[model samples]
Target: MESNPAGQGPALSGNVMFYKKPEPLSPEAHGSLGVKRIDQPLGFLRSAHAVPVTVSEFGMAAASFPVIFVGNDKTPVAVMGIREGQNLFVGADGNSDQDFYLPAFVRRYPFVFASDNQSDRLLLCVDREGPMVTDQPEVPFFENGQPTKFTNDAIEFCKEFERQRRATMEFVKLVDSYGLFEQKSVNFTPRDQNGQEGPQQKIADYWAVSEEKLNQLPADKFQELRDNGAIGAIYAHILSLLNWQRVIQRALRTPPPGQPLS
Candidate 1:
């Protein structure tokens, strides 16, 4: 249960996190767009190593993926792939298991609730690189220079996601204030000359909730955590570590590690 404080976790890539080519959805730019509601595969997601997830997702995400924290912000993320630029959940055919609980972060792709520092409003942005974004025909983003029903719905979904994101941030701050996080690293090794396990090699390090620190919380503070429903999430995170073995096993069947990624 002992841990070493690694100061901060690595930064997550903005590219892999969903806002790949974010552009404010505007009539001027998307006036002629007809984004159809069709069944399309997210083969592109194969390149994403991790995706930002909400606190609400901890329980469900832990069921399939190892939910971890990253960056100085301590953003909750679900590890989709063990190696860099490889998402094991996404098959070469570009489809994910339909039965698995898809994180809201992936579902909200191609659309983002962007903050405009100049104003207190959230701007709805769309990924210009989205495969579905086109000028031809099934769903129009605007009608008579006004947002269409589909576009409006997307806006509402983004707003809801933003609200969830805020609450998630609060949860992160709560955990941080409790001094329960520590830098953790996982190691792996190949067999040696006599078929014995070789030296363990560190592969990844990230911020995670420390079970020891968690157990050391003041009595009243611990009660407050339970009252606020954070106690369950803390345990869920600890339990999710079991999934890392599954993730590593998946990496063995895939392509060799390519480029190094943060």
Candidate 2:
């Protein structure tokens, strides 16, 4: 059998030469390539004869198109754009089914997109296994989202997800120990009957006192707290403080301190 070139595929018949774009183009341009639109929630675009494209290249064009869903069953997947920067984020959906992002096995694979505008496409293929779609009712979405589903029975997707969550919590606590969430405040409260305020009350009475005391705690102690569950709580507290800080800062910057807020 005759072999196709490394990057080039089989040639076309007649005087016409098959030319694949070096990158994926906008969905609107799909018509030019004879690609048909599949009416799915994810908004996938399909073409029978088109070649597969690389993720990076495909992403550039996919990002340009407003359609959130695009892909073919021959390549069961969805390509969507993430607003983080300019690059498009590609995802996979199964057989017109929902819950694409919940697959844990999918995370093991590095996403790929079409890299060229020509019909020839590039894709980053990973050997990692994926989850098999089962008849089980789709996992319910709730307060604590369901763990990623893995199609491959060989890998435990839930375990990996938990590990990542724990690592993230640890990092958050480390950041909170630096007093990054501390705030200044003024308030009036009564002291003890003996006219002597308790250390707890004093700390609350003077924001500077609390700040100084927190600062005195050894860095090692803070690290230890992070080793415990203190980090997650601290992270949550710091985020809350950050939001309050922004609100107060905006109020102070505006015309009147007490002016009816905008």
Candidate 3:
């Protein structure tokens, strides 16, 4: 989540990461606005080191980047870099450095669902500040005051995302109830030109699913998790931790400010 840029309509609940100006979509407010392809559409991601991920993305994302749980909510996030405001995977051109799984959260950018507490319904909103959104146009949001196919498709994608988000919340609650989380730290030991190890630097501290605790659970409880289809996601999280070394290697290649390199 970042600072709320001045806008109209109901404010989005929870953390609205990467969104600067989110306004409710409407023919009156944004009929002229449309999305257009650009060279660096995802360039905004360069400053984001971690992005939220749904449970469904665990296995796919695990193979690409380290997925870790964070905050009191135990929100799942894919770690992209060891340092703040540094995304190792996103190059200066805003494209991924290599082929990898892109989180749905990132893909659903610009369009998001905001809860309307009063109406007890979800409202589709667009980030008026999104790079792709423009008035000059390519794919118009609306035609003849009705939402165009592009807008309708975006709505469907956002709806599915919301479903996954709710499921992720339930998964977090289940894991928390079982007391399966533990505090973990990421540390990196840099090397000098001679290949000698330097002092280890602490990179981040976050909550993670504890394999020990998980294994120690009663057989019945373990089976319950399995029956509930949570076992796969849990193991996926554990396996993803192994990729921390991969992230460290990337950091070394393009070391962050203040970090020494070999």
TM-score of each: 0.83, 0.20, 0.91
Span of 10 residues, lowest total lDDT, candidate 2:
200-209
- Which is the winner by lDDT between candidate 1 and candidate 3? 3
- Kindly report which residue pairs in candidate 1 clash with one another: none
List the candidate 1 regions with Cα displacement exceeding 4 Å.
1-16, 37-40, 190-199, 257-262
Order of models, best TM-score first: 3, 1, 2
Task: Compose the digit string of candidate 1's lDDT tens values, residues 109-174.
Answer: 788766555444556777877877778858888888788898888878878888889989999999
Arranged by lDDT, best first: 3, 1, 2
Candidate 3 structure quality by residue, lDDT tens digits, 1-262: 1112234455546448888887888887887899999899889898889999999999999998889998888899999988898888987787976688889999998998887655567888888899999998889998997888988999999999999999999999999999999999989988776778888999889999999999999999999999989999999999999999998998878856446555
As for TM-score, the candidate ahead, 1 or 3, is: 3
lDDT of 1 at 111: 81
Residue-level lDDT of model 2, residues 1-262, one tens digit each, is: 1122334533322211122222122212211221122323221211111122222222222222211112211121122211111112222332322322222223332211222334343322211111211123242111122122222221233235435444544433444445433334422232344555434221111111133544567898766765765544333322332233322333233322223322
Please report, as a residue range, the 10-residue window in candidate 1 with the lowest summed lDDT: 1-10
- TM-score of candidate 2 to 2 decimals: 0.20
Tell me, by TM-score, which candidate is best: 3
Superposed Cα deviation of residue 228, candidate 2 (Å): 13
